[model samples]
Structures are given as C-alpha cells and as structure tokens.
Target: MSYADFARSIGLGGIAVDDPDKLGDAWGVALAADVPTVLDVRGDPEVPPIPPHATFDQIKSMTQAVLKGDPNAWHLLTEGIKTKARDILPSRR
Candidate 1:
C-alpha cells in the first residue's frame, strides 16, 4: 500500500505492477538522489566508466537523449540516468 501510495505520489498511476503486493521503487529512486552508476551491469568491463560525479557532457548526453524527439530514445536516456544514479547513490546502509 505504501508503495502504491508513493508511486502515485510521484505521478505514476499504473506503475503499480500487476500484483499490488510488489514493493515500489520510488523510495529507491529517492534514495539514489546522489548516486552515479552505469545502467547496464552486465559484467561487461568494456563499458565506459562513469565518474562518481558526472561530467557536463554526461549530463548533457543524458538530457539530450531523454529530451530527444523519440519516446523510445527518451526511455533509453532515462534508463541510462537511472543506472548511473544507482552507483553513486548513498548505499542506504
């Protein structure tokens, strides 16, 4: 219920997974406010690394990709941001 409430609070009405029993990721997103991480953790060391603090180009690339004309592009961009944000987020420990 709390997850649903939080998700709704963030303007995600249908994000409530098929089962209402699942946990909401809103808290995690909020928790990741200060973290930096790559979106795909496929153990592919070849993926370029992102610094603890992202550079202007990084931010710009993310924003451009997200705000790009295509919705699919936006999704990809947002996911990338989410990934980077995960690594830098305060581990919540």
Candidate 2:
C-alpha cells in the first residue's frame, strides 16, 4: 500500500505530493492539519543520488555496475546523464 493509504489505515491525516511544484502546498496543508499528518513525497527512483563532486573511481564503478546487467541500468544511466546535463548546462529560464 502507498504511504497515504498506510497513514489513513492508522487514523492519521495523509497527503501525497507527486509533483515537485506542489510541495509547498502539501507542506502548508500538512502543517495546518489539526491531527498528525503524513506527507508522502514521491520522487523519481531511477534518478541516482549523485554527489556534487563525484570521484573518477565512483563514476567508473557505477558504469561498471550498469554494464553488469542491472535491471534499471538504462533508466539509471539516462536519468543520471540528464541530471548532470542540467547541472552543467545553463538554464533556459
């Protein structure tokens, strides 16, 4: 079951925020709630948690792991590349 479902099962208020843009609103609702609240913020699992400054060895290990037939290899690599690109490239905004 989802976190929201689980929270409701235990008789607490629950809010699920799948969109990043809705995070502030979700927090507002949670904080304003009279009872205890559960804020279930769903995020992309395929996006690897890359450090700000990854070492050459760290990158090499990740690549090797992907090459070894990880189930989510393609998604992980693509998401990682996209995330890195966003950091390296200038923002359109």
lDDT of 2 at 90: 79
Put down candidate 2 lDDT per residue, 1-93, tens digits, no spaces: 489879988999999888856777899999999989999888687666778799879988988888698888888888787767776787665
Q: Which ten residues in a row have the lowest lDDT in candidate 2?
A: 84-93
lDDT, each prediction: 0.49, 0.82
- Put down candidate 1 lDDT per residue, 1-93, tens digits, no spaces: 445455456664423333212323533554464533222113222223456788888778856755666556655555665657666676554
Clashing pairs in 2: none
Model 1, C-alpha of 43: deviation from truth (Å): 7.9
Per-model TM-score versus the true fold: 0.33, 0.54
Specify the highest-lDDT model's number: 2
Candidate 1: segments with Cα more than 4 A from true spot = 1-54, 69-71
- Candidate 2 global CA lDDT score: 0.82
Clashes of each: 5, 0
Per-residue error (Å), model 1, residue 87: 1.8
Model 1 clash tally?
5
